[model samples]
Every structure is written in C-alpha cells, then in structure tokens.
Target: MRISRCVRWPAVVVAGALAATACGSFEGSTTSGSGSADNLTVSLQFTPRANYSLETDDAFVLSQVGCLETLVKYDAEAGALVPLLATEWVQTEPTAWDFTLRDGVKFQDGTDLTAAAVVASLQYLLQADAPPRAFTPKLITSVEALNDSTVRVRTPEPSALVPFRLASINTGILAPAAYTGTGIDPLSHCTGPYTPVAQTPAQSMTLEGNATYWGGNVPLKSVTARFIPEGATRATQVRTGESQIALGLPASTVPELEGDARIKVSSAFTPRTTGLYFNQSRAPFDNPDVRKAVQAAVDVESITSSVFGGQAHPAIGPFAPTEAWAPDSPPVNRNPDAARRLLTAAGYAPGQLKLTLLAYTERPEFADLAAVIQANLAEIGIDVSVQVSDYSAIEPSLLDGAYDLALLSRNHLTDIADPLGFLTADYSCGGGFNISQYCDPAIDAQLSAANTENDPQRRNAIYADVASQLQADAVTTFIAHEQTTAARLETIESFVDDPLARYAVTPDLTVSNS
Candidate 1:
C-alpha cells in the first residue's frame, strides 16, 4: 500500500493567516451510530442516481459499500486487471474469452458461485432496459457456461479490452435470486464481504458483514454508507465523529480536516479530468472556431490554484499526465487575444454571444470554477450565464444537447479502467454518454484502430493520436486532472484509498477501539 500525501499544509497556513479559525468546529451533527468500535459508518459523495440497479451506475454504490464483486478488478497501482471472482482468464480466440471462476466461492444467499450463475448475471445486464454503456449488445454477442467453473464470453468484434470491460462494476455477478420482476435486488444475493440489509432511497444503506465470505473472515461487523451529495456535509460528518470514513471531500474542507488530530486525510492522483464540455450539435459551439475560442479563454492554471487550492494538476488532455497512456505535451496556456480573434472569425461580435454554462452543485468547486470561467470568457467579449443544479437534474439536458456548455468531472477509468472505454463512450459518433455531442470521423477511425490493437504499446499510440485530435478540435477543454481525497478516522485500520473510486469497504477493513 503506497500512499501519496497531498502537499496542502502550506495552503492551510495561507488560509489560516487570511481567516483565523477558518476550520470551525462541527458540533450537533446527526451521527450514524453510537461510535461503536466494530460498527463503521462511511459518508459517500454520490447517492444512488438510479434505483440501486446493478445495470446502472448505481452498481458503483454497491461496490463502494463492499456489497458487489466483479469477475475481475482493476489494480490501479499495478495498472493491470487482477483476479476477483475469476481466478484466471485466457483469450481463447480473437473475439472470445474464457474465464475460470474461483472455486469454493459462495453468495451471501448461501448459493455456491458457478459458471451458470455468472452467465445468468451477465445475461441480465445484456437484456437490461438501458444496457451498460461499457459493453452493450454491439460489443458482446453471447455468454455461455462452458462448465460448472468456466464461463465463455463472445464478442461481436475482436476486443482486447474484454477483460477490462468485465471488470466494470455494472457487470458484477449476483445470485440468481437477485433478479426480480420489478428490478435487480442485491440484498443477500452478492458474493462480496458485506450483505446489504436495508436501504433508504437516495439517503443511506446498511450492510452486515458476510461471515461466510469466500475471501476470509470479514473484519468489520457492520457498515453503513450514508450518501450525502454535499461534500461539506460529508466532511463535517467525518470531522464530528458521525462517520468513520468520508469519500470525496471538497478541496475547501481539506484544510479544516487536516487540523483534526483524530482524522487522517489521504489524497492520490486519479484518472479523472474536470472539463467544460460544449454541445457541438448546437450553436455557437457548432462552429469549431467558437469551440476553440472558448477553449482559449479558459484559465486552467488559475482555477487549479484558486478553486482546487493547488490540490490538482492542470490537465494536458482528457487523460492525466501521470497516466501511462497520456501524451507527452506541454500544457495549453490561456490566450484571450487568440480567443477574441477566433470569435471574430466565427462571426461573433464583442458581447454578441450569450451562452449558458451549466454546473452541478454536487461538486462544490464547480460553482467556483464556473465563476472564474465566466469572468475569463467575459474578458473575450462572451457574455456567460451560469446555472447550478444537481447533476441528476442536469444530465438529461446534457445528454439531449439542450444546454450550451456544461462542467463535468468525469472519471475515464470508472466504466472500464482503460482509455478505450472513455474514448468510445464519450467521443464516438454514436457514443452513449457523449454529453459534448461531438463527432469527428477521423477521431472515430483512430479509436477503432486502438480497439483492435492488442499490443499495449501500439494501442497506446493509437489513443495518443486520438488525444491529440481531441485537443486540436477543442471538443472539450480539459480543466484539471483531479486527485481523489478521502478522510478517515485514525482508528480505522487497513483503510486503502482506491484511485479508481471503486471499492472502499473491504474484507480487511477494521476499526480499532484504542
């Protein structure tokens, strides 16, 4: 377990000097429990946007609470796919993969994990109302149980990323009983360390440790995950001892948490990028020059310093510079003069272009970042209006191209821990999650080439070309590569920070009374 500590103490000193006692005390907050040693409460950043469905992004909620397990898991540190429910896998053919399931594994429902069960779970996802964005029917064609211990998956095309696709939490295996007439019920039907017992819609969920977990004896007796969308509230819960662990603390709250002796704040660079996406299908962004002009107007360095408090690195592209696949290039500097010139070329006079910039309040820094961008764009004669709302309320408008510009914090590795998944789902002509409404045949061609290239170096080269094309087109102005910050009580032992933001509570996590 390597930990990368964030150098935020200097910023704390600066903050303290400006405002004395800025790190105010959090008292009288609602606590999760009586602060029991064996009982752990975690504050999560996102509530279940969907109805806790395994087929949607809500699967991540299940994984974070240790109630879901995928066949394979991404080892962010190792930068490779590792075994989870599946012990080993082999590419038997260009379009086919055979995964050997681990023996002696049992679902919390008391059913033994089998190849048939794995096939059933995947089949459920394939037949879902809105299939998983990672691997839909377009990608995967069939799933068959070769034996009691082996499952074979066949894709429509030769995909080297099949293993990584299976690693997505949306494909998490569950017992057959989980599939109900209404929807998938994960309670007591998963093969993870914890079994979800109760849930309050969009609020909180309670889970009890699976004593018969295949991995080993679960260390924590119980775990409760309270989904608080407000980052400050999550931080306050951890600070006031209402929660033992908190995920996704805003940068503004880090200094305050650092002042607490009982709390340990851990930060690590992740494969996430915060960017302002343009609705390419609509005007004035329909014009490439306008998109470029907006890109040139953004002051990424200032936003990184002021809003993130130097906690994040300015992004060079969609992928983080620290990632192996990221292109080796210089950061794009803001050029307001060029922005003015480009806007003129796009036939927009000074103060003629009025645009709406939408940002979600879930990420508190987004509001601050939007203000800075609004000011920057105004300098180049673009009049911008900002709208702040919950992400759930804005997603429909984003996907339908109803908005002009949107601020989004996207994790490239969340769907599949590879660049291909992000590239295909977010930039392709018919991308499922293409909020930008961007489409370029040249970039799509590069993505196709990367999808088929099995060789790691060659595949990365194709993606590098795609990244270059995306930047040149100004499809979205990548603001900064964010680092995930988590705060946990000092008493929590073996608390590992997942750079991928997948698994949080695990079998080895425990609490110490002393």
Candidate 2:
C-alpha cells in the first residue's frame, strides 16, 4: 500500500486492545460525524505528497475523495472500460478516437462541461512541465474539440488502449477555471460528487457534496478525510468512532479489527508489489552478475511469512499472480550458495563489498523486510547497511540514483489498468520513474510492441515475455504481491472495495445513523 507521513510510531501491536494514546495525537482532531446520516469521516493512509498536484500521483487523492471525475473509469470486475463523464467512445481511426460527452453535465463551479472544457483539461495535462506517466505527448499527440459535446483524441502511434489510458486517475477532467498561470485550484472546479471546501495542507481536507452532481443526489452532505500515516492510528480512529472509514490498514492490525462488532474488515488481492530495486547506474550493481547475486541472496518466502503476516504472497514477477498477465512460473527459492558463486564470478570477494539498503517507514513492513534482507545478504558474505527514513526524504535520492539499493512498494496498474504503462514508465530506457536506473533495448522493444498490439492475447503474451526477461536479467527483486485491506463502520453502506485504490467516496455511498 502507498502511504505517507514523516513520523514513525513504535512497532505496531499485533492482536489486542491498542492503547489509544500510544498511537500518537493529531494536531487537529475532528469528530467522525456519525451522529448524522448526512455526514461521514474517513482516514486515509497517504497525505498529499505533491501538494495535490493533478499531474502527479496526488491526483489519486482527488479521485478517492470524490472531488475529481475522469472521462472513463475502468471496471476491473468486467475487465472493460465504462463511461463516466463521456457517454460513449468510438475509434474513428487506428490512432484517433472520438468521445461523446454526457448531456447536461456541469462542473461543481456551476459551469457547463463542454467539449472545450474537456479539450482544455487534457491539454493542460499534456503540456504539463512533468507530464503524467500514463499518457504523455509521447503517446497522445493532440486532443481537439470537434463540437460542443464531442472531442477527438489522436495518438502518435496506432493505439488500442486509449480508453484505458483515459480511465487513469491522472487523466481526471477538471473545469477550465481550475487551471491558472501558477497552479490548479480544484476547490469547486471539478465534476465529481464532492467539492473540496476546506483543507489543512498535510493534515486533512473537508469536502461538501455537490448538489448539481450529474450522477444524482449524493448520500452524504459532507465528508472529511484525515491524512494519517500510522496504520494503528487509522484503526483506532475507526474503532473509537472517530472515523467511519479507514483505508490502508496494516496487516498486523487486521486480527484486532476483525473482532470489533462495529467495524468490518475487508481485503482483496491487489496488483501491487514490494520490490528491492538496484540502481544499475551506480557501481557494483552496474554488473548484471552482481544484481543477480543480490536477487539470489534474499529470501522472499521468509519475508512474506514473517514481515507481512502471510497477508502477501511471494511475487514471481512484477504483476500479481492473480492478474491474467502474470507468468505461471513458480517462486524462486532462496539459494545462498548460488548467490556466493555469482558474487565470485562478479569479482567480489567475501566481505569485500559494502552497500546501503534504503527503506521508508510509511509501509510499516519495510523496516522488518530490510532487517531480514540484511541478514540474508550477510549470509552470502555481503555487507549491507540499512537506512530507514520517510518516503519523502528518500524519494529524491532514489530518483537521482544516489542510493545503492532501495525498497519500494509499487502498483503495476496505478498508471493504467494494464501493465503496459507500468512496464514502459518503470523499465524502459526513457522511463520517467525508472528508479532502477536500468535499461535494455530488448525490454524496450517488447514494451513498444505490447503498446501497439490490439489483440488482448498477443499483448498479454508480450507482457509475459518481458516479465521473463526482467527476471533473467535480475533487474529488480520482486518481493511479494500485497493484499489491500480497509476497515469501515458497519453502518457505512455501498462502500466500494476498489482493487485499484480509486473511487473511495461516490454518489451511492451512504452512512446510517441508527
């Protein structure tokens, strides 16, 4: 799970009554508003990492809080695209698609959602200083307003997944007024069911239901989302009735919450993986044999069992095993002997090489995982020093390739529902978020082919091949596939357990007072 906050709490208590005071205190605490059916309160794991920039991953906050709406939404269950703001879409040409906007849709700012607005919103994203990874100028060439209710999108190459690209939260549509010379102001310039009326930077955001929402009357009058990083605190908030909904609960807190009568715990296999990435741009890691040796040193099964409490399964590739694109290979067994041999082949003598393993505290499990990995590497005669810090502090160094190794939890489908976008943006030569700082022409070729392949079967086959290549290259050690878990008050109805971590608050959601 992607979580944030600079503070690191004491080790989480596994199964018992949590001392409410031990979870630490919030500066500005608010009631859950459970006394009234018209109000609701939610606790989220991540705070705004980029000050709620629509161009960055912060867009997900807008999406989950119901303050933003996209042209299309991905229905993971149906394995198909569904209309949201746009009523229907058709491919006019291999590289061009025409979308028909829903009639009478209005932004929360009381402005009409016209084709011009859609064009402007998309243009803003495309022309951003840091374009969204899901769809950039590299893939999308232009968006033109054909008429008052129609728009045409053209891509640089023949694309079959334009609809899927539009479904990404990063591609969410906003009113033209939201854009400014300095930055975006999404207070009332969105078309979603809720409108942000108040915020406290990294603390919390309060949203009021949009009366003119095109989806019909929203069930709640107001909603407050608190940004709490500690998983135990999030659980305590839900248990104490301070919040009705708590998302991103740590696995260790599940057993305790499951016993609560008022709270209902929900979990699902997600397309997220925790990985140990090597900065290939740096020293020893520049050698493929060294990377392979490190991969062989780590025990994935032990980490999954001891650190995650069995909430996660050993990952064989970047994609989750439950995902259709995942390869059917068995998990790699731990082999310290093989690791030592590889190190010898790579010209590294026992105890000759020393490296740093960076980890962030937001995920909670990273600390434990880091310790286990450090011990495992020691057995292979590798000296590893573990460094734990907040993700915010570690991000710059990770991106700059200043770190030797790092632990990262990534969602393969966050950019788009398909793994194609993830593969391209994370592993390709010019990938924007290539933390590994590793590149290969063969992998790039496979990703390029998958992007243009319209046939689902062929595209999936290409993805499997790329996965095999990545494993063979030992570009990164795929640790484990995570299971997303959340706890909510039983009184909250129509709660969506979205596997993609999108659309937490919606028009159908309701809170019962009795």
Candidate 3:
C-alpha cells in the first residue's frame, strides 16, 4: 500500500508513545481524533469484486484495497492534484505524455514498482471487455516504458482529462503477477493502504494494515469492514455504536445520526443516477410522442424530496449534474393533460399502453422506486410491471433487451471532462455499457466528433446537443441522482465529505490502536 511516513518503536513502552516493544501490524500514532477505541470497524455498502475495471460500481468498496499507481493523486489538503506514485511528470505533446516514476517504490508483493508494471496495468485496462476499453483506450495507441522508472503514453489526440482519468480508482495499477484466470484477481492486487486478512459472507472482512507499504503503515492494527446492504440497519450500526463508521446511509436517516452528538454526517455529489432506459429501437419507444408522454408522467421533484428526504437531485439527462456538458433540460414535472394529448396522438388510450420494467436488488431502494414509478404511471394510462432480481440477472436482461424498460443506477467518471464517457457507452449501438441499445446516426456522429475534438467549448456544445436530442427522443426516463451519505463517530479525524471519498489520507487515518 502507498505510505507517506515511517516509524519504529523502541524496546520499552514509553508514556505518551504509540507503541512499546512488541510490534503490531497497525500503528502507534494518533492525529486529532479523540476516540481511539481498542476495536474499530467500518460498514461497507457493497460486496467486493473479483474484476476491478470491468465493474465501475465496485470502485467505492475496492478503493479501500489496493489500486493503480498513477502520476498524481487527489491532493485533498490542497484541493488539487499532487505528486504521488510518480514524483513528477512532464507533458510532452497534447496526446503524447511522459512520466518519471518515483524511485524506491515497491508493490505489496515485494515487487519494486516500475514503469514496466505500470505499462502492463494500463494494457490490461485496454484489453478488458468493458466499455472503457474500446472507447477511452481507442484514443490510445502506445504505452512505452522508456526505462525502469520512466514511462510514456501516446494517445490519438490532445487529451486534457488524461491525468484525471489516471487518478480514477478504476485505473489503479495491478501487479503483473496479480493477473489470474481470465480477468484481474482484484482481491490480490497490491497497491492500497490495506488488504484483506479474513472474509466472511454477510458479515465482515478483517483487514490488517499493510506493513511493507511505501505509503506508510495504517495506525489501526486492523479494520473490520462489514458489508451492510440494508439501509435502516446500516444507519443503526452507526447510531448505536455497533460500528464507528457507516457508508451509504439513506438521507432519510441522516437526521437520526445528526440527533446524536457522537455522530458526524458527511455527503457529496455522487456520480450516480437512477434512470429508466427504454429500448428505443422497438415498439412504443420508437415513437417520439409516446416517449414524450412517458416523460411527463412522472413528477421528479416530489419523488426525490418526499421519498429520498432531499437526498437526491432530479436527473435531466445523460451528463452528470455538475458536468459542463449537462444540458439545460430541467426535470419534466407530471403533466397529465400533456401526457394524455401525446398518448392520443400516438393512438394509445387509457390502459392501452403496457410495458415491463426490469430492476436489480443491489440497492435496497431500487425495488421501492420501481414500485412507486409503476403506481405513478398507472394514473397516466400506462401499465407497468417490475421484474426484480439480483444484479447479475438485471445486467443480462438489459443487455439482451428482454425488458421494454429498465431501472438502472449508473456511476460515472469525468472521462474527457463531460458526457463523452457515459454517452459513448450508453447511446452508441453495440457500445459496452449501452444497455438501452440506442442507435442514432446523428447522435453517434456528434459523440464521435467530440471524442477527438481538441476544443473544449466545441466538445461540450456537441455533447449538450446529444443530451437535448436524447431527451426529445425519450431514450430514457431520467430519474434522480441519489446522494451518497457517510456517517462516522465524531472522533474520526480529517473528516471531509466528498462525492469521491479518499479516507485513507485522513488525519486519523494513519493512527491505529494495537
């Protein structure tokens, strides 16, 4: 794991010292945290992954483990990018960049970190069957290791967001030896602050501090990360002191934690959205009037504020809410009158339209949303039935276009600074993440132009047009972006609420109880 500091203990226990003679796995330091309970635990929101980059949703949980070594890391202290795995890097050409790897860095498996391994890890990403492989890496032509500690990556054109993409946990480096079977054995990748010692289903994983990490040893001798998918019980774990930290607490329960002085709440703009994607190539979805009618059937504001307790924002289109490419299309409020007119224009009468919706059980809220949406649509002459199952089932269902409509929550990264990352995957036919199977030659042309375009403003305008066009076409029912909430005991230090959390660097992060 990456460490920025080092410490050693003497033979005797010294007063006010972190450790005595016996060495433990964690650490002997305390930052600003007041509570250093003998035992500490954190509740995880999802299960661990065997394949890293293939599944974007798993990044949040996997970030707790090892990841890729990049030229820079998010400098939370400075609120900008700072040197990390790479001491310093020089930008040669807009697309062709050179990096000088840090000296004396070692992987978790005793392998010295080198440019060769970094190159291999990126090649692995390019080879993956995931959408990013074909889309992002298609812009890349070569990755050459100039020396043991220097590497160069050459892309098709100028890429301003390359560094940001490098910082993504999904792009974290994997040891050359870590590759096993057909894909990455993510559980064994060596580059993080901690690694798993014991794993128990529906229970907890005892993560011991990585001692050989160059980044520095964690202060906690061990961290027990429990997988708690249940929303109410997850919050209870934090409120009742069963666990010091709870991840993904529903916003409805935030007030309960706020009521407790011992608990602190943290939240950020999550790159997640709950949406309904239509099979645009088929049936009623092919009709623009039917699509517009469906959009007007849902009341976005009430659904978010009332059901999510103000934890979510209405989604307007494919672009992330804060993205520059996000269009000005506001949430379509329920307009039964308008919906009826459109439905009639499409030759659909009351109760004449029927559609099936597919949903997954990965999130506790998906079923609830589907049920609410199904009931809501019944009032607007549409009949919907939700087919719920595990994520594995839902994924294949979406890919095969088995369901007329589907409920999906997708996480996004700032690939190329805007919707290029998501649209290329979701809107293009045969695209890796294109569950909707949507295909519009004009939309594809615009997206393709934005991909290679060097001008930022021009690219954003192109993507904005794509967003507006998709809305007008009714390719998907843009629901809302559910907020991700984190609750921790007040004793935790360096508590910064964020959309992308990097808690490993917290002030108390290095502190441990042995």
Candidate 4:
C-alpha cells in the first residue's frame, strides 16, 4: 500500500470569516473558494484503501468522486435511471439482459470502453481475492460480450433488476490494463469525468477532468480531495476554506456549521441503515432468546432523537421508509422488563452474564450509539464492555467471532435497486459481510424466491416476508436510517446529494463568482 501525506492549511480565522466571505465586506484578501471556473477541493469522510478494484465500498465512492464510471447510475433527484457507460439496456428474456455501450467513450489510459472490457471488470469482482466478496448480485450466472458496443448478461434465475444490478459500482467498467495477473491496478484503467493525476492511498488524491469523457462539458477541471476520517476535522476543513465541499459531516456538527452564513449544510434521506449485528456463533447470542432480549432492550427513539438530534428516522426493518417495498411495520418498542425475563428464562444467571460490544468510530455517532446500547443492556443484567476503533481494525475481530456484538452501518439498496442484494450479502449462509456468522435456511429460501420472481408484486411480497422473518428471528437489531449530509460553501449552486453516492461530481456543478 502506497501511503501519501495530506497537505495541511493554517488555522481558520472563524471570528468573522463567514461574514467577510459572504458579504465581501472585508478589505484584506480572505481565503475562500477556488474563485475559478473549473477547480475545486473536497474533503471526503471515507478514504480509499489500497487495491481499489478489490474493495466494493472504495470503488462505489471513488467512482462518483470522478475516478471511475459505472454502466448505469440512479438520479435521486429525478427518481429515475440515468445513463453512464451504457446508453441503453433491455431485458430480452426473463433470465437474460442486453446493454449497448456508449460510443466514443475512452478510459483514462486512452483505451475505448468496449463490451469485452465490461465483462472483464465484472469478472474481476468475483475473484477469490476480492475484498468485498459477494458484491455482485448472486443471480448473475455469466457476462458475455456480444459485439464491440453490445453486451449480454445471463442470470441463473430470471431477474427483473438486472439493469439496476449493472449500475452498481462493482460493475464499473475498467481498462484491460487494470486486470493484472493477480490483482487490479488501482490508479489506472478507469473511465469517468475526472482522472486521477496523483493519489495517496487512504489519504488524498488529485484529479483532472477527462478530456475524452463522453459526458458533456467537464466543468470542473481539477479536484484535490483529502480523506479526513474524523468528522470534526471534515467540518473544520469546510469552515476554513481548505475544502470547498465536505462530504459526510456528522449530525452533531450540523447545527454549529449551519450558523455560518457562508457554509451551506445539506441533507437527503437515503436507503442506508445502521444496526446491531449479533454473532450467533458465539455463546448466549447463539440462542434466539438472548438475541431477542438484546433487541427488546434497545431504545431506538432515544438513539434517534437524543443522539442524532432527530435527524434520522427509526428503522422499521432492513429496508428504509423510502423504499417502495418497505413493509408498513412499526418500530421496535423498548421493553427492559421483558428483556430481563427472557434473559433469566434462557438459563443465564443474573448480573453474571458478560459480553464485549465492538463498534467503529468512522461515522462519529457510532461510539455514542454503542454507549447507548451499553447503558440500555446494563439494565437487563448483561455486563457489556465497548471497544471502539477503525473499521479496518475491527473487521478482523468481527469476522473471527472475537466480539459478541457489532455495530454496523449498511446501505441496503446501494448496489441493487431491490434490497435483495444487501439481504443476501449480509444475511445468507454465504454472505460476504455476514459478521454475525448467522445462517438461516428459511431466510435463505425466501431471499432466493425474491431474487428469481419476475413479477414486481410477488417479488416485493416475498421480500416483505423475509424482512418480517429476520426481525422476528432477531438476526439483527435495526437502529435508524440516517439522512446523508454534506457541507459546502454557500457559493456552490449545483451540488446535489445522490442517495447512492453516485453522480455527485458531475459536469453541471459550479461555484458562484459573486
């Protein structure tokens, strides 16, 4: 992994900085926006790890930040599907789909975007060494190049959301050079509005607009992005003019940043959900009664209102309220007494049961959420110790069953339009992200049925049934689905938050000169 140092700026003069920048009343020169036609700097909440192609989350985010392009994209504002590398697509048969590649599109390496390249990129995602295993939809059986501009997709079962699946970051088409003997070349072989000129793995990256891009008018010429994992640091970058745009500001910082006239805070409700995953392979949690007890002990309203400042909606199930297939289920009610009773009946001694709760500090609120759970579980006679660290460090413990419970945030519909992709990835027997090591044959059957079902109504009904079953079984306890937030200079006019985090850095965004 190649690590690079991030450039730092001097302390911000926040006393009257916003007033001076907004009103243009200061006499002396003040550092503000780029004040140019096509140059900007953004601060990202998450950083890219080494081997970008192997990591699905890194690919999903960087693809939007101008590094790579997906075959299709979702327009959150329009609530419709938009074209990227693939211009048009259709379902020729129940189990087969066809896509026509956009002409004249060139990769960063000057290679043409062809059907064979798309197939190779998709194939790379299924490699044994892929970081995010099971990123692609499980229904896909094979990908074949029909012609220079056309591609065919085959699924083991009839899939209605094949186009949506292709639009995922895991399917981002790459140049042939990226497919090396053993791994993918991270900084090369990508096609997007912007191309990486320099990158520091997990720290910062510099990008220049692609002249050969098929997309219209690449307004932004250059972008320097610093990955500040700390939320407070990210907000600081926005206020200090070090970063023109800051993505993923913590909810706690929104009120303070909103006070600045020059800093604009924006948010959009997304399909992402934060929840507590129980390791069923571990003792006590292996019992369904104990899992239900922990679920009953949690207070979702308190966490949403007090911890999040009411910026989020309590999760009813895996799918958010914005999802079309979300079941009209009520949020879990807090029942400490019932939780204690269940714990005692499960042959656990009072005040002697102990467990370790693991959580990462990336989201800023995760630590606080863990504390809330700690306090809530204490009442039910479960002694809990919280361990907070980075996700990379905690992931090993999660996978190996070193922790009794894990606090995880997941986007249920980011990869696929339907929630099945996330369900199968996080819950099934072969789930790649299954931290809890949970496997239920009944739930697996329901997920398979939903994936193969062609009828929309029937598919959704099956998904609803699976959601109910998961909740009833207490596979994981849903906390809340938060609204994605970003902070930028008030001069940013065309900044729009895409729910899936794609289509964020486009040609239309511009900063006002006035």
Candidate maximizing TM-score: 1
lDDT of 4: 0.74
lDDT order, best first, reads 1, 2, 4, 3
TM-score-superior candidate, 1 or 2: 1
Ranking by TM-score: 1, 2, 4, 3
Candidate 1 regions off by >4 Å?
1-31
TM agreement with the true structure for every prediction: 0.93, 0.93, 0.83, 0.89
Per-candidate local distance difference test: 0.83, 0.82, 0.64, 0.74
- Top candidate, metric lDDT: 1
Model 3 scores what on Cα lDDT? 0.64
lDDT of 3 by residue, 399-467 (tens): 777768888776544331245666777887646677777788878777777766656677778877887
For candidate 2, lDDT tens digit of each residue in 1-514?
2221111111111111101110111134343445588989998877776756678867888899999999888776555667889878877887898888999999988999999999999998899888999878998999999999998999999887787788899989988877765666777888999988877778887888999999888888899998887878988998898899988878788888888877888877777899999999978999999988988889999889888988889989787655667777777788999999999999999999999999987787888899999999999999999999878889899878899999999988789878888899889999989989978898898888888876777888788888878887889999998877888988988886677888789888999876
Q: What range of 10 consecutive residues in model 1 has the weakest lDDT sum?
A: 9-18
**Which residue pairs of candidate 4 clash?**
none
Per-residue alpha-carbon lDDT of candidate 4 for residues 1-514, written as tens digits (9 for 90 to 100):
1111211111111111111211111122222335475778777777665456544566755665777777777555444557778877877777787888889988878888899888877776755354344344455678889999988888877766677677677667778787666455645468877876666556776777888777766777787777778988888888888888887778888887888888888777777888999988868889999999999999999999988778788888887654656777888899999999889889887788888888887788888999999999999999999998888788778877778888988887665656777888788898877787889898888888877666666777777778878788888999998777888887777877666666556667776665
Alpha-carbon error at 109 in model 4, in Å? 2.0
- Listed per candidate, the RMSD to the true structure in angstroms reads 8.6, 8.7, 9.7, 10.4
Q: What is the clash count for each candidate, in the order shown?
A: 0, 0, 11, 0
Q: How high is the lDDT of residue 257 in model 4? A: 84
